[model samples]
Target chain A: MEAPERLGEVVQASTDRFTAQCYRLYGAPPLGSLVRAGEREPHVYGIVSSVTTSSLDPTRPVVARGASEPTEEAIYRSNPQLERLLRTDFEAMTVGHTQDGTIHQYLAPLPPHIHAFVFRCTPDEVRAFTQRLDFLPLLVGARTPPGDEVLAACLREAASAHDQPTEFLVQAGRKLALLLGGEMQRLNTILRRLPL
Target chain B: MTGREESPEVLGPQLLGVVVGGSLSQGLEVRLEDGGVVEELKVGTFVTIRGERHRFFGMVTDLGLASADPRLPSALPDTTNPAIVRILSGTSAYATMQVTPSLVVGGEETSLLLEGPQPARSIPFHFSRAYRASQEDVQAVFGAEDERHIWIGSPLDMEDTRVCLDLAEFVKRSNGVFGKSGTGKSFLTRILLAGILQRDVAVNLVFDMHSEYGWEGGSEEGHAVKGLKQLFGSRVAVFSLDEESSRRRGLSPDYLVRIGYDQIEPQDIETLAEMLNLTQNAAQATYKLASRHGQQWLREFLALEGREELAALADQLGEHQQTIESLRRRLDRLNRMAFLVERSPEDSVRRILEYLDRGTHVVLEFGRYGSDLSAYLLVANLLTRRIHDSYVRRKEQSLGDRAKEPRPLVITIEEAHRFLNPQVAGLTIFGTIAREMRKYNVTLLVVDQRPSGIDEEVLSQVGTRITCLLDNERDIEAVLTGASGARELRQVLARLEPKQQALIFGHALPMPVVVRTREYGPRTYAEFGFREQAELAREAEKDLKDLFG
Candidate 1:
């Protein structure tokens, strides 16, 4: 089951199974974090490919950083009004959605419904999706897709959420070792960043 | 360093970088690890990626330092800010390598380094761990042995490890030793011959073209490198064409190779023409004269003293008068070589065959005659023709007599390109033997520096090629033609040390290997059965004492 907190709402849907639009809430999901949406049995699942925050007003420019701030979290806390001015959005590559209950790693038979309720996938959902690591190749590509950081963040979250954190990491590492035998740099980066 | 070999903590070479990029045709891209704690892999060094059920074998073809952003210079950035320096130092910047997978060996048996199809996927694993191949991995793949296997050289990475070559397969067809001059061609040939001789697999007949295969040959520093005769005395009978030169070198040559001038045929004279600087018409004159006067043509032609008689024969034969004179003048020089006698001496070809039939190796030393091109060509061609013809006949005779198996013979010739060059190959008997001498129980161990000059037909027929450094493009291509994985090995071949390294591949070896050739002096004698020979001699002495004392 997905978490009750709505991570985002599908703002725009596409006939292209690869892409979708989401209006992010106060907390945007981490890159590569598995998410669920769509109002029907064939709910759409995706990995976040990118995340960005922008000013809602067309004429104003927004800046998140300033001097004399102890930390990013402190700035956010001190300026709650900043959130109203700026809205968060994210892009998800629809790797595979679920029909009834089985996970998949291919494009949906049909486009995801518009304005579907999108939410963060629970730890169990993430584990089930990663059962065989079939999604790994879908996320990685040759043309420097900025896939490393996304993969690392997802792996760290998934490993920490598993029953045996270190063992899960080792298992994933072994799978990645075989899957990325020739892609050492990408592999090492993902491996070194495992939460275990 | 502390982990057991089988343990997860196994101490082997570690990764330097991620394989973030590259295509199949261009090659794979790998970033090196941050530091250089591991052994720096050379261009030809082999590395392996451990997949779930398979191990991928790859050769490192190129190494370079690279940056993620092309605009960024690779040099460490010069900056005063400590924070910037710290961040820059930890950046994803380091050495990178281009790796080419030549083989992907994996199966339940795990021993076979199979030349199978490349894996379906370009990358076997998402992030496979790489380690330098272990000794067991190498041995299982390369050191698989059988009775016919002979250890030729050690692998470049594995010290004191012997790499075995399948000799039975190697001797079944012709083979060659090719390299640039001074690249240990002779030394490698000597080791190969030693394997053949010590195994008693075949009898060898070496045409010592430079007088180098018999008692002694010059080393790179001009010191004497011991030759075949010194290494295996009684087993190898060393014969010389020039008796005085042999004696001058203080060698007791087993036989003085003598051929009656009457034995020289029209074809023999034609082969000698290149050395004699004779025109085609002059060479044809010898044939015309031979047909006119039969076996006594040389003597009769020499006996013709008057120009009136020469003019009469020239008119009668429709020959140019000057061509006839030039033929006679060139033919006259043959009398000056000491080895060509007009009359009685032992039949040299018969003697050589008898020795070979008895399974004794023969190295025919040209001695001073080796430098005289005309004499060497005439004698080598005539003798090789006779031996090859007799072997063919003997093979025919033994077709039904399994008990009387014709001894397998391997004829060793230097400057093989001279006899096997395309221009002369059709007429040269050595080329015939090179092309098709297998079923007759004969083969050639052709030693030459210029393999490119050898006839393509003959080169194509050569079974195995053990080449030293060859900078010539054609020679390298000729040696590597039809060899498996030769394209990847070209990088390896180019980097061989000019002295004692050789790249051995083809019919005999399981795979292409670049090895440091075995040292020839004491190490060679020790490893190649000198101790076994001594034990046999001691046992014979004991048996004699037990019978009589």
Candidate 2:
């Protein structure tokens, strides 16, 4: 397997989630992509739940300068300082963690440390983590807006990592059915997003 | 996934479900596996539950659908989507069934093979896996066909496996074959009769009301089906009450039974009171005349020529003239019966006894008189009373010598309610035989459609009941009156097909089983040593040529 692609560094952390700053101004991973943050063993795994790009300083508000430029690239070329001033960060909800090379589909005892390198998991890692689908209920129970969409996106991404992606999604859908049995409307909304 | 647990390993390919709840009396509840299609599980199919240490045999009595959440039904999610249907079927919503455990085979494997199955007194533990009963399991429960056991048919949905009845035990007590008219009661009765005759378990004296058991009876498709006489040849003797009707049907019976008027006792008249619609005064007047005129009462009474002579005789016997007139009116119905004669040259009862003594089964076809219940009631009552008396005498004399005991006799009667109903059950000889005949070496094989009309006591005493489709609620209740797990068996009995299938339970079977009754055709005939009609005709032709030569 190829080396895991480096994505960001964790800048903020909590028991269930962490915020990571990307290497470039707009280098955040796509929503629902799985990422691990750690330099050694016991890497905390999470799914990208949200993303944002803003000035590094909370009090600073940068003004638009592209009105007179022929395209957006010209404004960037004229203002090279803008890339250094702005930062891209993504929030990931912790779904599980790896311990002694075994992926446990549950919360890690401790959150990722500040500035821990975050890496986009390889297809093999996603396949290994989604093998059991025991972590589905955690995504379903996540306290976030568009939780259903994030869960569906995560499943779609995991499905692509398996030999029989449709079969894997069907199995995951069955687990979600048990989790959301009483909420048929919600379950239907999530299942409709799953690709054939 | 928060509370998920590993699924148990299914022990066999036929694994159906796992036991969840229930009791020994109410049956067990099983939640079907996710891979199982609820449509494939049918009620009345046999199942085996593998418990911690025992294997419990059961039948699927009921099936239903359940949802994990109560609001699923009202929400009514779109079921047209395949994904939604697939996910919700076994997890969010699932199928459950009720299994009534009937028999239990316990102990080590070797001991279980030796001891066989016993009645289940306990329920399987929770989560015990249940599977469709394999052929070997069913074979172990219902023993293989042999001399003492007769293969009746296969259990429901198991065409290759067999369900045998222990005929040796079946003949020890009176049994019943019940179904509504045209439900193939006659065909099932024929099968049982053939089995009994083939095994020589007991000697049968069938009062064939429709002449269906003597010569050849018509099947539901209007084709000729062989009767006992045709199947067993010399081993079975056909007696006819209407010689003309028998000859018209191309049957030359071995004997033509004629009941002499002098042989008609007061009890016979009393037994016919219901069929003849005789009043209480008329019924009593028969005893009065019998006491006065002795054994020739019926003959002398029918000989009375005028109203004045009857009045004088009524006055002589100290009976009311109106009562005597009523008795004369009802007794006149018997005079129209052709089988009744002024004096029969030979005793039909002795002739039957002779045939029975020779170990030959006898079927007395009622012929044209079968439709007349009065004639049937009179003759059946009269002959059975004498037979019962003779059996009692012989059985009493053979007390210390078991070998001298008369061969067990199974007297088969159709429209059994007429002779064994509650009103006349205590008064009729058939009722006596059904109640306490085991000691006297006599039992009854009752064939009837309206079982509710039979005496409840007699119905309870029916050791084994092989019942076909019965639509009436009362009839169904009557057949399953005293059965254990009757509520479960009721569903099985009611759902039986209108033809060929029957639910047999009681002494003959260890547990209640629904059977697709064996086909009564050329194969069965050949099994019982019956030659084909064309072959028999050729043999007869050869016999004629030899005699002439």
Candidate 3:
């Protein structure tokens, strides 16, 4: 109810699609994990496809030089200034929108407004939305070549997000296997790379 | 509109799923609603998706039930336990269905036809709710009550829903019932016959090859099916090729119609050639025999018994003398046949035709002739030739009066593929009837196990095809090819349960439908309104007795 601690903010918006930049804090929502944005009447839904960590100010040249420290953690701990230079941002692909307590598993008539709050979808919301694997094709057939890996990551994140995530993950994995049944090698790659 | 009893609730059946996305041509995929379990929906179930302005009806082809998460292990996890089932109930569970949109109803102007909505043409509003097709929607889609609707069976989806075929359209075109052995093709045929008799739209002449359709027939489960003659006593006349045997078996045939040796036409022998395994040279000898002896080919050919005399005629005809001699031996077998009149029976063929002409159905019982392919083909071809020819002439000659007109005729034959094969299609009278049946007001209800054996042209011309389960790919292809509903029907045809289920398609109904074939046991027979006509005959007799008194 208290905005669930904003994970990110919408960076761009289109008619039915939008991209959000996550906060430079904990690891961003895994690929395929659903994230929510927008407010009031139309709440936009997206599936994370990518995560990036880069200098917040692109004009500034921030580089990590090899320090003579025993461990990498010590080097990072000693040079705390490096942490403030860059930020972690996750990108989500629009899959659907929900409004007035009704879920629409299709592109929204309007996208999330720019700078709208981005938050990880609640376990209850994920449970309600993923009742059917109808949206798998959108992630699997994404124009990007690494869509499969992204789908695998998002699926694992979704599995762990719920209390009974194991059974859900196993069933979801079986479905994923079925969808990719024709491509044994690709299916195996996704199964092997799954976060679970 | 709302207050009247005639205008019931317009809302379709209960909500089942919502369209997520899918290609239009192949079909669309629907995601189940909350608490909607995949197991609740069966294959062949019909669902409706509301479009912007129209309602799209779809038949479930494939069901999708899996984990929504790809990261789950590839090996299927055991979900047999209640805990697993509870786990399986939530959103991570993937439950979807592949549905082929078959009909579009509920627009500004409503019309129903065979054509389906074009794929990717008018896509359903994405995410719109797809409901379990309501009673009203089904009534609108398959209502044949106004037509001569023959209640054939209940749909496999719902038990109480009667799937009726428009008997008027069914009789107008040649139809076929095909299935593997023990798939209840005979039961479906019997039920269809009952409908025809009940409607009295057409006079049927069934060439009962198995003797299973006249008085009482052997059914799939070896139980008895009270035949058409029993249901329509006065309206249905039973004739037997082997009347003595029929009587021996206690079958009281209406007429013991026998065919003489003279009635065996060259073409009849020619049609039987393939079944009899006759050589090309031996088959050609029948033509030579016919050419030399106009009306007495079989008798005269058998009379030339001497090897030398046969050799001389064979040499003159440029055929093998031994082949011709063996042909004599084969023709000799018919001499011992009790049904084969050495001297022609006095106009037996005409007597059967007279029965049909009087608007009475005829079921020609074959008795012992049922198993003898040579005898079956020989007698069937000979009798059908005369009947079809006279009917053709009468149909062509008739001018105007409707009441006195020759009734539309339906000739049903079992093991039809053997007679309708490509080798004999051009020659058999059944083939000619199959082709021009509509014009001659004659159609065939061909029953066979191997539809692939029948000529493609004849198969294509069949009007309504009610097919039970068949495993043979060729048989499946044969029934599906050239049908308007072939593409989507493939799914329906594939899903028919082995026992009493069937797919009914073609001219008889608006769309192809999967049916759990109607009940036809003796106990249920009286309830199907089959005895009303027999009761009428009883009433008529009582009237005559009263008048005479």
Candidate with maximal DockQ = 2
**Which structure is stronger by DockQ: 1 or 2?**
2
- The local distance difference test score of model 1 is 0.72
TM-score of model 2 relative to the true fold?
0.93
**Could you arrange the candidates by DockQ from highest to lowest?**
2, 3, 1
Worst 10 residues of 3 chain A by lDDT: A176-185
Give the TM-score of chain A in candidate 2. Answer: 0.96
Highest TM-score scorer = 2
lDDT digits (tens) for residues B1-549 of candidate 3: 001223324663667677888876777888876345577776777777888777787677777764556544554444454533433343445588887777776554333334323222365878877888775666666774543887787766678777788898899989999999899998999988888888888988998988888888886556677888777778889998877668887878888876777888778877877766778778788888888887877777777757888999888778888888877776776776688766664888789888888888899988888888788888888888888888777876675545555789888988898889999999998898898858878889999999999999999899889999988889999999797536667767777789899988887776677888888886777755666666779989999999996
Off by over 4 Å in 3: A1-196, B1-12, B34-36, B66-93, B110-123, B144-147, B399-405, B485-488, B532-549
What's the lDDT for residue A81 in model 2?
94
Question: Would you give me the overall lDDT of model 3?
Answer: 0.76
Candidate 3 per-residue lDDT over residues A1-196, each given as its tens digit: 3234468788877754467776664458766788888655588888887777878799986665656788878877887877777777877777778878787777788788888988887777787777665667667667687778778777777776666766666566656655664554565567666544
* Model 1: per-residue Cα lDDT at residue A196: 42
Q: Compute DockQ for each candidate against the true complex.
A: 0.04, 0.40, 0.04
Tens digits of per-residue lDDT, candidate 2, B103-159, equal 986544565677789888778899998988888889989999899898888988799
> What docking tier does model 3 reach?
incorrect
Per-residue lDDT tens digits of candidate 2, residues A41-122?
A: 8899999988999989989997889999999899999999999999999999999998999888899999999999999999
| Better candidate by lDDT, 1 or 2 | 2
Q: Model 3 reproduces what portion of true contacts?
A: 0.00
Off by over 4 Å in 2: A61-78, A143-145, B1-12, B34-36, B106-111, B314-320, B532-549
Sort by lDDT, best first. Answer: 2, 3, 1
